[model samples]
Target: MPLCFQELVTPLLIDGAVSPLSPQSPLSASFTSVLPYHKDSGILSEAEAKKAQKALADGNLLEVVFAAIETLRRVPSTRVNIAVTGDSGNGMSTFINALRGIGHEEEASAPTGVVRTTQTRASYSFSCFPDVVLWDLPGMGATSQSLEDYIVEMQFSQYDLFIIIASEQFSMNHVMLAKAIEEMGKKFYIVWTKLDMDLSTRMLTEGQLMKNIRENILENLQKTRVRKPPIFLISSLEPSWHDFPKLRDTLKEDLSDIRYHGPLQNLFHAYKEIINDKVTYLQEKIATNSFQNTPGMRDIDDLAECLKTYRLSFGVNDESLQQLARSMGKESSEYKAIMKSQDLQAVITRGWKLKCLTCRVMKMFLILLSYIPSLDALIAPYIRQEKHNRMLEGVAEDTMTVLKKVLKDFTSS
Candidate 1:
């Protein structure tokens, strides 16, 4: 039987556009105008009506509802939903709070000390674009349900990345999670959190502990029969400023070029870019406000400082980028090529940009020499030239080292 154009087009049109309007609104007259086109296209069919009725009975309308919601979330106004899960006290909440630059251990928003925390999946979001949403899922190993049923109920694979966090040793649950991820072909990371605790613990030597944990993690993977796994250790309290940067770099290296064409680095990138533009605008505002009354200027200055701090919350900074570049070297660019098919020019451009930025920041330290500041202007220029040359050389050396290390790691792993 031929389909009913009237019924099909009615639902799609309502879902796509008219649903957002009030039902009582006169604009519904426009919906009436389409009936003639529907009649011309075959106004109705018994099969289409039956399927529609079944969909309603099954409460399948949410497919369209969620389609609308997803479109909304992708807009700059709505929050991007990111789910983070792990064992208790593994710094999952801390990481999310820190991602927003909020003090995770503070009174209200503290990451720890809360009893019965995050029993079910709950969302926390900020007002910013690619607005941030951090969902804390219930800890695993507590529930006795089968893994397949649990995953089906929670829709676990919908997340961008499944963060598997642990402190001392990886558990069977971690192995199970990894196996499930492998079977389902999902992206995941082994985040070895609480490095600082291990470092400070009197019971175990830090080096041995780290080694044993890595081995256990590998053993766990073998037990699950996973072929390749990448693991990282993180200290939420003063995370190796360098280590977290490397993780961020890794995330960038792993995403495909298609992912980059839009806002990259999760939804946070959208928020980050929006905040950057806002910060730039506010800075200009402050400059203007400074020329106004003194009290007004002070208030503007305070607001500006607050916004600047928020701008820094997402872990975007020149220092971190520079350190990551130095540690990663040219391998960073090579990884970009492999993941995104980025050209050599793009790689070199980033290398030179980081190299220049590092030198620029370091030049600030040269002011301390101003006390003796005895270096003549000529000598200063010569020193600058020497520094620039060294910077370029360092970038080149580091790039090669990182490239070799990444290739070796990839092949060996």
Candidate 2:
């Protein structure tokens, strides 16, 4: 179903049941909401916008992820195209092979050589990461094309992320590439590959050498005013040794965010626009209509009812979530996993919105609005719209979260 605000408040369940989430504290019975994003910063960057709905339809993982999403989100399959680049002979191809658990001799492994074996851009993939393509772009060297020329030739804008590889020492090429990538508002990592060669030097012990390498890379980046990103010290040949595993694991872990970054932002933006329009309409309708006998603002049951409203809106209350869990063949409690906070402040403030009613704030806001009849004849009507809109948004976000988990469950191995 194409997502619409009206469909929600009264949604027809999709073909499949979706999935779960987090923590606990004193459940405050108040109407508080976390708006997804602000108006000015809401829209995604150009690059991210290109990665979503439009591009996902053509992405490699679409068939599988699209099907799963149809049952819940109906959005596109997220893709993360990572470009691994460096000067010739920096083991860029070797790193790609290692990351995919393949050797140079294996089929589809990125070609490696003492010279520039990667003549043009080539890509590799790993199982369960169909949407993640590791591009083995032709190496950039001082004697070769200029940085500007190389960037255009490589179509740098197409890659979602970058991995700048270096060995022996940090070069001006690497530093320049990193700075350029950063300037473009993209994330890049400094992977000091060939760790074996760097470690062989006798001047420093292993730990000292590692620290020295990190400092040297850091210093080079610092001079150029480049943001220090995760710098991995790894030997592509010995993948399991050094930081190769950590780098790979980190890369894999980051894909979750990388994948959803575009689609989720687009979805959130669209949802926000829909909700904003609804809030405006609701505010007007509420100001005119008779909202009879909503328990007096002072009633304690009003707080309880409001809490239930919020919970039911998000489909997070115990009974509904339990039924969802059961329908999905999952443990009901799994959907409500709580992480106990040991911090006193956090423990006390946790769920403060769910447990306590902020009636005073509501009353005060209404009293203030009461002075402005031009705003609303009945201040309570405006507050009702405020509460309903906030609750609607919270519900929308929770729905997106569940959709994400469900997609993950279907896509991940």
Candidate 3:
């Protein structure tokens, strides 16, 4: 008969009892060989695991888990804002439309014309990219506003990236804008528009004209100390020509890197914060309990029991580990091998051996401390608390080991 899920995991969970489920009860021989790499692949390190354990011992798990969940929920909604700004009649709207892979006539396209059509900051979404918005900002120096005031009013700090558009030679206004963006430690691209017009009107070869334009732009930027900002020469009417294709590809790549890494970084930070909070709570609990004179308060049985409880709480139990393995389409034994903790049931069954040893050591220490008079009461509670903390640390480390294994399996699969 085929084994039920509970039956499959039961032997693995049982203390000191070998399962007949397979030749290797908890894990296959092959999985044991690769277990070391699983430890290293997780987002948290052994040091971080120790910190987390301390936090859990000192703090509340429920609050940390809630904060982590809330932070993760916000990740999907995180928006990458890109701003396109330049002088009026510089094809900012047309460039935006082209960048979004939509024609100017399309209902969703930014309004395009010879005059200043984008009066205010109008946002458009990229169909191919989710949670990314492109803002077609009103032209700089369009009215009596100073360049600095224009930047402030437009809220230049809001955008993650900036695309500055120009049709002709890079003007003094363009240089100032580039300098301002550079001073603020922001990234911007210089796009020389109307390449098609220049190619048709100029007698010079396309290569020569492009070379001259690029050199001229670079020289002007150098004057304002704007070093090596990405400059692209392209025609809005013919995006296929010049650097338009490269520009599009580069933007996508940049956005992809930001989108992928941003959330992971934020989540990593949130995990640290949660762990810290947990540690604080655990510390307070330990201190308060240490001060109590009652025999129940000094007992270490509850501390020993926490190891098994923590393993189950972190989904490191045989059943949870097996479920994770099944989700990844791997054998249950393969997942079990990566776990750092002993089987929960096995630990419970054989726990009395360790408990006996611990009790003997504590009794011997107390007898010796009793002769020290004033120091006995002062130091005994702290010693007991330290032992409990060490057990908690071990449990926390095992929890992290199992978590890392699950994360590695999911990402690789």
Candidate 4:
């Protein structure tokens, strides 16, 4: 509210940097476009986008963004889990072996057989997804298990994706499984096994047979909520042929979604929400004189301490930045060199106070104006509240700027 603070903030209180941001704002445009909904940001599909949105809704906004920022540094070690499920003798285990590029009967390969080889659930790991685990769940028995029970027993929620193995026909059970998985709002793939057999059968041409199989699956799923899911027809024995390579390619694409894309999408949404929430809270305080209850912020000069508080909360303090630099094997100057948040660190100084003191005309006028009785009661506190609100906005903007730089460095690295 001090006349000198005009240098740091706008004159109008409404001209805050952190307003309830609209999508069209410059700040919003600098980040991901998938906040309220998904836009093809080269990462999130409709399904992954929904999962990210759910994660945002269920989590602390700032925490979600910060965690995602941290994840950028740990992507190599991040894990993604996949579940392979099917009816007994339907080649779920064979598909797992093929998908992992491990031949049946090879070391560490999933056991395969005509009977239920995977009686209890078995997990497989490959160097392809370092920390990844693929669980070959016990088969959904032929008319023996209920859908509800199958869902619970498999613990479907733990896996990021489900591969439902089908063969010979897309049976009622297969359609039901698809419906249930789709209903649960899970991402899945329909992998039709033994396409080699279908091709060798003398009934139809290979293309015609494949088309017929796809149509049959689609026709049976018409009444179900399972939309056009990624369906792959492959021979589990011939990993190099059919949809096996394409399936692996899809995994490559989606695994990135699992780690970075969807979470990054949520990060943007939450980041905006955090900015809006901070702005709204501070603005409400300005409206109610509630910041008068704030301890130690006795005057605008005490803003040094206030800025310190903001720095600490946003992890943009000198110490925190230096620590982060050390963690990244870089100099603190590297991050500080580009950070506007550094404004808070040296914001309050003797030179700054001297400059304010030089504005004697405004001070003298304030002095004369102080004698205006009831206006005197209003003037000082109003300025003080205005200063606090602007300081809050400045700190919030700097924090977001720091996050942006961190994200930039992360992506470039």
* lDDT to native, each model: 0.44, 0.59, 0.61, 0.63
Instruction: Pick the TM-score winner.
Output: 2
Q: Return the number of clashes found in candidate 1.
A: 3
lDDT of 2: 0.59
Off by over 4 Å in 1: 1-81, 105-111, 126-132, 202-208, 240-242, 252-413
Tell me the tens digit of each residue's lDDT in model 3 across 13-49: 1121322121221111222232222133134455544
Clashing pairs in 2: 27-354, 27-355, 28-353, 28-354, 28-355, 28-356, 29-354, 29-355, 29-356
Q: Can you give the TM-score per candidate against the true fold?
A: 0.41, 0.60, 0.50, 0.53
Supply candidate 2's per-residue lDDT for 246.
Answer: 78
**lDDT comparison, 1 vs 2, better candidate:** 2
Instruction: Give RMSD (Å) of candidate 1 vs. truth.
Output: 24.8
Please identify model 3 stretches exceeding 4 Å from their true place. Answer: 1-74, 264-413
Ten-residue region with minimum lDDT total, candidate 4: 1-10
Regions of model 2 farther than 4 Å from truth:
1-80, 100-113, 116-119, 123-133, 142-144, 255-282, 293-304, 310-318, 321-413
Name the runs in model 4 displaced over 4 angstroms: 1-71, 261-266, 277-413
lDDT of 2 at 180: 96
Q: What does candidate 3 score on TM?
A: 0.50
Per-residue C-alpha lDDT of model 2 across residues 1-413, encoded as one tens digit per residue: 21111111212233343422221111211111222222342344433333332222121122212333442344445677999999888889888877777768977777777766878888777655666788988878734679999999999999889999898879988999999999999988999888788777657788899898899998988999998899899888787788876786667656655765665555555433433443343334335543233332234224345444434433455665565555444565664553122122322244454213245675677678778887756555555655444443444444445545544443331
